[model samples]
Target chain A: MIELQQINRIFTVGDQQVHALDHVDLSIQSGEYLSIMGPSGSGKSTLLNIIGLLDRPTSGTYLLEQHNVTSMNDDTLAHTRRNKIGFVFQFFQLLPRLTALENVELPMVLEGIPPAERRQAATETLNTMGLGERLHHRPDQLSGGQRQRVAIARATIMKPAVILADEPTGNLDRHSGKDVIELLEQLNKTNMTLIIVTHDPEIGLRATRQIRMVDGRVMEDNHKR
Target chain B: MNTPDFIRLTLTAITAHRLRTALTVLGISIGIAAVVLLTSIGEGIHRFVLSEFTQFGTTIIGINPGKATTAGGSIGVFGTERPLTIDDALALQRIPNVQAVVPVVQGNAEVEAKGRGRRTTVYGVTSGFPEAFRFDTAIGKFLPADDPQAPRALAVLGDKLRTELFGNENPMGQRIRIGGDRYRVVGAMQPKGQILGFDLDDTVYIPTRRAMQMFNRESLMEIDVMYREGTAEKIIVKDIKRILQARHGKEDFTITTQQQMLDVLSSVLNILTFAVGALGGISLLVGAVGIATIMTMAVRERTAEIGLLRALGAHQKQVLTLFLGEAVVLAAIGGFVGLAIGVLGAQLLHMALPAMPVHTPWIYVVFAEALAISIGLLAGVLPARHAAAMDPVTALRAE
Candidate 1:
């Protein structure tokens, strides 16, 4: 479960103050498939960043799993981010030098896992993503859809509680984008909390719960499918 | 992360830019090689000079006129000093443990031998000269032990002076004129090469009292006292001082022990070695600069990777260690390569110039490698800290 109350994110540009998030509040329960959809500069990405613990709110009281995460130290925030949250970027940010398996094994590697155990687990994870044959291929050598799948595998390798995808299919073709969305939906069916931030109405409508924002404020929330 | 994994990661990053890494390594290697080679030469010269000085014998003490005020800044040479005479030299021979005494009066003279005249240094010495200074006679014999006050007009030609004035012809029993005095060549000395630029093979020796009359001086320039081995230096110096002070009615002479001279010379040469080593260290400092520059550039290039590592739960300390590890590995490789090149270069130099002494001590070899590693650690600090301090969000967004 995640809760936000009176969360405000402000940006100072030279002499003026811009409110990226204007005193908005929202709540979500476990196993909810949700999407934050708005036009450009609607603060959807900022909200997602705050929820992912990548950035702190200017004024916020954020509670994730009944713990006040806004008051956590930087190191604790990093620990919580790695253990409780996962991210799939639109660009499929895989390190170019690492193979598909190595990219997926990175999270466990940072966790100080042994080489043999992590190697086996990363192989299985990549194999389940239908990248068994492409396990040794680098990102530069893989197809766009395959790269996105690798990124998805890397995100879920640590078995985090929630998955945050920011325009996960923005850079892919229609077919691969559909494949990525179906894979994500499959994970959602397994009771993983899935939150997506996108401008595409089709992708936004696929979520069981949808929220639309305007000028840093939540204008619409449709919780019933 | 575990050490192996951490090393692998660092190695991966270093090998990513092969050309850049090679260039950085080359910079550090050149510095280490410079340090090794320069210090090797300095140490070689240090030993060479010491052996040359000690070859003449180390137990001999020289008593020079005018007590030098070595303890404080004062001009003792300008004081009224009594000139040490042949009598002082004869008195020192009576002291216990005294082996031989040679009262010296050195002067340049034109010697005419075999109708050929040449200018050479003439040494006014006694019969104990050859034994006391370890000089050998290549032919005939040295000056015989005759009466000190009145002795034969015998001359011992130096090795080079024999070759110059006599050629292949035997100079023994030949008459040579030294400063308008005719003397018979009793012997020719064995070839002893130069000592501190003084040609030991180009000098002539005669009786001390005769040379004092030839140079026309009342006091001997110096009196050399040769003592038996294992004799304590303080006792010999004390006995010589007591006799000379009693005869002169004051302590007007300076007695210099060979050990004291050796200690002073050894310390001066050590400083010379350290100075050259420091000069080489300057280049090593430049190499450290090269490492710092490359590491800083690497940090800039890998900002996104750093952010990703942080996102994957790598701590700030981990990021710092990764960068520092890369630096240390680079420097260590360079150090090894530099050591090989330096030792090989020293061998090649010795082979090319056999007369030049070249020695590479093992301690310097070990120290040079350690210096390279420490330089790497020091150079990596600022850049590693900068990389570790980067904000994850901003770094991830960087192109």
Candidate 2:
């Protein structure tokens, strides 16, 4: 679970000061599938980054399971982020030099997990993601769908509590996009917090909870049965 | 990382850019070669001079008429006025370590043959001069000891002077005119070519008695003495000076020994060798610059890879060490290869030019190698810092 109270984020470009997030307050229970919809410059990505702790708010409080992580040092924040948070970006950010298996195993290696266990866990994770046979293929050598699949497999390797996917299907064809969203939804069904940032209305409508933003403030936060 | 794995990684990365790595290493090789070649020349000349000087009879000491300061700033052979006499020679021969005493008188004279004439410097020496010089005559016997008494008008020609003035004729008992006198050739000096390009084979030697008589000098101006080996030349010089002071009642003569000659030769060589080594250091400087530039480019090129590694939780220190490792590896390899090449190159040069001995100072080569590697490591430091200092977020944001 996560809580936010009057969170605000500001950015300055040259002489003009811009408020990216303004007095935002929100809450998400565990296992919630949330889609944040916004027009260009709508502060959806900024809000997601703050929630993911990749960016800090200019003011106000953010409580992730009652931990006020805003004041934590970089090392402590990194440790918390590594253990509990995973990110699936629009570009699929898999290292081009590494094969699918190696990329999936990266988070475990970063956690200082032993080699044998890391490889074995990475293998099982890949098999569950239907990429066992394609484990040795590098990102460039794989299809867009396959790379996204490998990215998703990597993002979940640490069994993180939260998954933030910012336009994960942005670069995929429609069929692959459908498969990626459906797979994320499956993870959400298993009590994993899933927050998808996107501009697609059709994709936004399928979420159990939807928040729409325009300019810098939230326009709507609607929960659907 | 463990040392073996780190070494393997460095090797793999270098091998990935084989051409660039080889070129960088070649830069260091040239620096090493320059040092080796220059030092060899210096050492070769030194050894040649030393060997020749030793061969010309080191036990002999010459008292020249002029003040003799060393070529370098070591001993000052300071005295003037041609202050020696035959009485000094006679007194010096009575010293404890004294073996032979010879007085030499000399001048330049023109001798002619078939309308061809060349001026050659001639030495006027006693029969004792040949004994002091340890020269063996091959063609004819040395002049008798009674020559100083009867004062025979006979001469001994050097190998080159013999060929020049006689042209294959047995000039023995034949007359050649020089210095207002016609002297018969008594014996020829054995062949000894040159010392540091100074011709040893052009001089003509005649009896010192005849020389003093011709030059119209009643006393000896230069006294040459020979001493027994393992006897301190200084002690013998002291003995001669003591006897001379007692006889002439004045301390005004100078003595030179073989050890002094060797010292002068060493100092001359050290300067030349140091200059050459310094010049080669400039090339090594260029090689260091090469390493810095290459490391900078490598860091710039690997920006994304660095971001990727940081994303994998590599610390800033680890990233810095990786780049530093690459540089250190490059330098260490270059140093090892350069040392081998430099030493072998010096030896090969010696073989190629047998007349010029190419002396390889292994200590110097080792020092150069150590410096080169240190330069390599130092050169990489800044670039490695740049790579390590990059912000992962910003780097990832950069295309």
Cα distance off (Å), candidate 2, residue B25: 5.1
For residue B238, model 2's alpha carbon misses the true position, in angstroms, by: 6.0
- Listed models, DockQ each: 0.50, 0.17
Q: Point out the worst 10-residue segment of candidate 2 chain B by lDDT.
A: B73-82
User: What docking grade applies to model 2?
Assistant: incorrect
Q: A1-225, model 2: which lDDT tens digit per residue?
A: 789889999998899999999999998888899999999798998898788776788998988888998897656666677678778878788876567987888777666677688889999988988888998988989999999999899888888889999899999999999999999999888789999999988888999999998877889999998
TM-score of chain B of each: 0.89, 0.80
- Model 2 lDDT per residue over B1-399, tens place: 345444554565677688999988887767766766677677777677677777867888776543443445434443323456665666677878777788888777776544556688778776777677777676886766653545677788788888887788886776776676877778888888887776778878877777777778776667888888888887887787677768655555566776787788778878877888788788888888888888898888778767655644555676787789888878877777777787788778778878877777677777877887788889999999998888665565455
**What digit string (tens of lDDT, one per residue) describes model 1 on residues B1-399?**
788888887887888889998989988998999899888989999999899988879999999998766544455544667799888888899999999999999999898987898888999999888878998899999999888889899999999999999899999899999999999998999999988788888889998888888988887899999999999989999999999999998998888988999999999999998999899899889999999999999999888888777766677888899999989989988898888988998899999999888889999999999999999999998999999999877888777
Worst 10 residues of 1 chain B by lDDT: B69-78
> What are the per-model numbers of colliding residue pairs?
0, 1
Shift in Å, residue A11, candidate 2: 4.4
- For each candidate in turn, give its C-alpha RMSD to the true structure in angstroms: 3.6, 6.5
- lDDT for B153 in candidate 2 is 78
